[model samples]
Target: MRIEHLAFNVTAPFEMADWYVAHLGMQIVKRGETGCFLSDKSGMLLELYEDAAAPALDGFSFPPATFHLAFAVDEVENLLRALVKGGGRQEGTLRTLPSGDRLAFVRDPWGFPLQLVSRAGATP
Candidate 1:
């Protein structure tokens, strides 16, 4: 079976949905008062749940040891610039792998780590 969707407990679901749409080119598949579902052109889905009571866990403040989401882009540097322009923060420097792939890490508006990688010859 293939992966369906990744869920995030965010403080502002609608804002997060808009951020993804504006920056990552995701579209809203469904929206509700407490949550929203978004999908990319390839049908990859993301679920965002609004949890006002959710504990604040900024990467720098709390340091989450959990998983991070990685997205493949045509160019890592361009995506990094887009992410910063869209209000996301670049956490670290961009690195090039020995395989000639580039990787950059950034934190979403709500502080979730996201890896942007060059999709030169990589397959889904």
Candidate 2:
């Protein structure tokens, strides 16, 4: 069986959903009183909602090493700058591997870590 959407318990589903759409290029599949479902350009699903009965997964508890949403980027530096300008915080220094892959980390407004990756040939 294949996995479906990944879900997150957030304080503000509506606002966080909007933020992801604005900054991460996600499209809202559906939004309702319960929560918001978002899809990447490729149609990978992510659900954001508030659940008073569930534990929250903010960056403080999860931390970058625990988990992060990664995305392929044409230019890590450029997208890194955009993420910060869009209210994300720089989590660490940019790194270029011997294989020529570029990697950068940042945290969203709610403190979720995001990894921007540029494979060796993915970027000029």
Candidate 1 residue spans exceeding 4 A from truth: 52-66
Model 2 segments beyond 4 Å from truth? none
- Cα deviation at 12, candidate 1, in Å, is 0.8
lDDT of 2 by residue, 9-76 (tens): 88888888999889888999999787999998777899998888987777766667679989888888
Candidates' C-alpha lDDT: 0.81, 0.86
Q: After superposition, how far is residue 67 of candidate 2 from its true place, in Å?
A: 1.0
Best by TM-score: 2
For every candidate, C-alpha RMSD to the true structure in Å:
2.5, 1.8
The per-prediction tally of clashing pairs is 0, 0
TM-score of each: 0.84, 0.92
Q: In candidate 1, what residue range of length 10 has the lowest lDDT sum? A: 56-65
